[model samples]
Target: MLFPVALALIVFATSVLSGVFGMAGGLVLLGALLALMPVAAAIAVHGAVQTVANGARAWFSRAYIDWRSLGYICAGIGIAAALLLALRYRPDLATVCIVIGLTPLLVWIPRRWLALDASRPLHGVLCGIVGGGLNLAVGVAGPSIDIFFIRTAIDRRRIIATKAAAQVVSHLAKVVFYGGLVQAMTGADWWLVLVAAPFAILGTQAGYLLLQRLTDQRFREWTRWIVSVIGIFYLGRGLTLLLGA
Candidate 1:
C-alpha cells in the first residue's frame, strides 16, 4: 500500500515535470521505478504510466503537433517494432544503460553536421527508427529525441507537443515489446496504474499551465541543460555498475 502510494505520488510529480519541462518525466519515472522493481517490471510499468502522461500532454498540446513529422516517424516506428518483434531482440540492462548514458552526449555533435531540416520527412523517419529502437531497449528516448528537435526552428510548444506525440509511440512500443512480461508483472500492481491516472492528468495540466508563463527561448535553453544533466546521471550510474562488475 505504501509503495503504491509513493509510486502514485511520483507519477503525479513526474507528469507535472514533463508537463512543465516537456521532457525528463520518463527518465525520472524510470529511475524511480528501477529502484523499486526489477528491470522488466520497471520497463512495463513505466510504459503504462508514461502512456497516460504523454497521451494527456499530446492531447493538451494537440494544436501544435507537426502532423507530417508524426506520420513519417510513425512509419519508422512500425518498421523498427516489426524488426524487433521478428528478431526477438531487446538489449540487456548493462547495454541499455550504457546506450542511454551515451545518448545525451549526442547533443554536443556539431550543428553543421547534426542539424536536421524540419520540413523533411526522411529525417523524422530516421530519427523515429533510431529513437524507437532505443526506446524499446531502454524504455525512454526523450533525451535523444530532444537532440533531434533542438536543431529545428520550431517553437517550444510545438517541440513539446510533437515530442509527446512521438513518445506515445515509443511508450506504447515499450508495452507491446514487453507485452507478456509486462502484463505478468502488472497482474499484481495494476491498481497502481489506475490509482495514478487522475494524478497524472492533473499533473500534466499543472505543467501545461506552468509552461504558459515561460518564453519559448527560455524553455528551449532550460530543456537542453536539463537533458545534459540527466545524461550525466545515467552515464555515471551505468559506468559505476559496469566498473563494479
Candidate 2:
C-alpha cells in the first residue's frame, strides 16, 4: 500500500516535470520503475503511464503542436520500432541506465555540430528514428529528443507540445514492442498504472499551468542543467551496479 502511494506520487510529480520541460519526467520515472521491477516490465509500465501522461499533455497543448513535424517523426518511429523488433533486443538495468546517462551529453554538444531543427522534415524523421530507438531500448528518449528541439527557434510551448505528441507515439511503440513483457505483468502492476493514470493527468495540467509562466530562455537553460544532473546520477548508478556485478 505504501509503495503504491509513493509510486503514484512519483508519477504525478514527474508528469509535472515533463509537462513543464517536455522531456525529463519520463527519464526520471523510468529510472524509478527500473529500480522496482525487471527491465521489460519497467519499460512496459513506464510506457503505459507515460502514454496517459503525455497524451494529456498533448491534448492540453494541442494548439501549439507541430502536426507536420509530428507526422515525419511518427514515420521514423515506425522504422525504428520495426528494426528493434527484428533484433529482439532486451536491455539490462545497467545498460539502460548507462544509455540514459549518456543521452544528456548530447545537449552539451556545440549546437554547430548538430544543429537539428525538428521543424524540417528530414530532421524530424531523424529525431523520430534516433529518439524512438532510444526510447524503446532504454524506456526514455527525452534527452535524445531534446537535442533536436533545444536549438530550434520554436518557442517553449511548441517544443513541449510537439515533443509530447511525438512521445505519445514513441511510448505506444515501446508498449507494443514489449507486448510480451506486458502480458507477463501481474495484476498488481496493472493496478499501479491504473492508480497513476489520473495523477498523471493532474500533474500534466499542473505543469502546463507553470510552463506558461516561464520564459523561453529559462526553459532551455533549466532543461540543460536538470537533465545533466540526472545524467550524472544515472551514470554513477550504472557504474556502481556494473562494478558490484
Candidate 3:
C-alpha cells in the first residue's frame, strides 16, 4: 500500500515538473529512488521506467522533435554510456553527491555567460555525456540537459518534445547497459508501474497545457529560478552527505 502510494506521488511530481519546466522528472525520480534502492539498481530501474514515460511523451509531441540536435546528443550519450559500462565503476556516495550538485553550476556559466547554443550538436553531445553519466551515477540527468535546452531558447513545446526524445534514448541506453544487474521486476513492481503510468501521462499533459498558457519571458524566468533552487538544494544535500558536519 505504501509503495503504490509512493509511486503515484513520484509519478505525479515528476510529471508536474517535467511539464512545467520541460524537464527534471529523471532527476527527481533519481533522488527519490536512491533513498530506497541500491544506487546502481535505482539508476537502472529509474532509467527503464522513465524511458517508458518519456517515450510516451515524445510520441505525443512528435511534431516538435529536433531530429538534427537529437542525433548529435544521442551520439554523445552513446559514447558516455559505453565508457561508463566499460569502466563499471561506481562513485562513492559523497563523490556522487558532490558531482551531481556541482554539475549544474559548471554548465550554468557557459549557458548564461558564454551564450552557448543548445541547437548546436556539440552542445547536445556535451549535455548528453553529462546527463547520461550523472544518471548512471546518481539517477538524475535532467538538470544539465535542462540547462542546455534553456540556453538554446527553444519554445515550450519543442523544448518538451526534444528533451523527452533525448531522455528516451538516454534511458533506453541505460536500461540496456545495466540489464544484467536489474533483476526481473517482482509482481509488486509491475503493479506499481501499471498504476503509475496513467498518472504520468496525465501529469505531462497538464505540464504541456501550462506551458501553452505562460508567456515566453515568464517561462524563461520560471525555468531559471526553478533550476537554481534545485541546484542549491542538491549542493546542500551533497555537502551534508560529504562533510557530515
Candidate 4:
C-alpha cells in the first residue's frame, strides 16, 4: 500500500521536473523502479510510462513544435534505433554511468566555446542518432538534444514543444523494443502503469504551466543548472557502479 503511494509521488515529482527541464524524469524513475523491480522489467515500465507522459505533453504543446526539424530528427532516431536493435549491442551499465556522468562537462565546454550551426541537417541528424542511442541505454537523453536544439534560433516554447514531441517518439520506440525483449508483461507491470500514469499526466501539465511563466533568459539559466545537477548525479552513479561501491 505504502509502496504504490510512494512510487506515485516519485513519479509525479520526476515527471513534473522532466516536463519543466525537458529531461531527467527517466533517470529518476529508472533509479526508483530498479529498487522495486527487475532491471529489464523496470526499463520496460519506465519506457512505457514516459511515453505516455511525453505523448500527453507533446499534444498539449503541439502548436509550438517545429515540425520540419522534428521530422529530420525523428528520421535519424528511427534509423539509429533500428540499427542498434539489429546489431544486438547491449549497453554496458558501468560505461553508460561514466559517459552520462562526464557528458555534461564535455558538452559544456563545446557549448560555451563553439559557434553551433543548428541550421545544418547533418548536425541535427548526428545529434539525433547519438541522443536516441543514449535514450535506449540510460532512459534520459534530453541534455544532449537540448544542447543541440539550443544552437538553433527557435523560441523557448518551440524548443520545449519539439523536444517533448521528439521524446515521445523516442520513448515509444523504446517501449516497443523493450516489450519485445520482455516477452510477456507481468501483473506487477500492469499495476505499475496504472499507478504511475495519472501522476505522469499531472506532472506534464504542471511543467507546461511553469514554462509559460518563465522569461527566456531565466529558462535558459534554469536549464543549465538542471543539466549540471543531473550530470553530477549521473557521474556519481556511474563511478559508484564502476567502483562497485
Question: For every candidate structure, what is the RMSD over all alpha carbons to the true structure, in angstroms?
Answer: 1.8, 1.2, 2.6, 2.2
Candidate 1 residue-wise lDDT, 1-245, digit = tens: 68878887899899988997877777788888777777777787788888899999999999999988888778878888888888877545666667777787766666677767434688888778887877887877766676667567788888889888988988888887887655447456667778888888889999998999999868866776777788778888888888888
Candidate 2 minimal-lDDT segment of 10 residues: 175-184
| Per-residue alpha-carbon lDDT of candidate 4 for residues 1-43, written as tens digits (9 for 90 to 100) | 7888898898899888777767766667776876676555666
Candidate 3's clash total is 0
**Winner on TM-score (1 vs 4):** 1
Could you tell which candidate, 3 or 4, scores higher by TM-score?
4
Weakest ten-residue segment in model 3 by summed lDDT: 106-115
Per-residue CA lDDT of model 2 for 38-118, tens digit only, reads: 889999999999999999999999999999989989999999998888898987989888888888998878777887888
lDDT of 3 by residue, 110-223 (tens): 444654455897887887887777666566674677667756756777877988888888878876776666574456655666788777877777777777788877876676
**True-structure lDDT of candidate 2:** 0.90
Question: Least lDDT summed over 10 consecutive residues: which range in candidate 1?
Answer: 181-190
Once fitted onto the true fold, the runs of candidate 1 whose alpha carbons sit more than 4 angstroms away are 182-184
Model 4, residue pairs in steric clash: 101-235
Q: What is the C-alpha lDDT of each candidate?
A: 0.79, 0.90, 0.72, 0.76
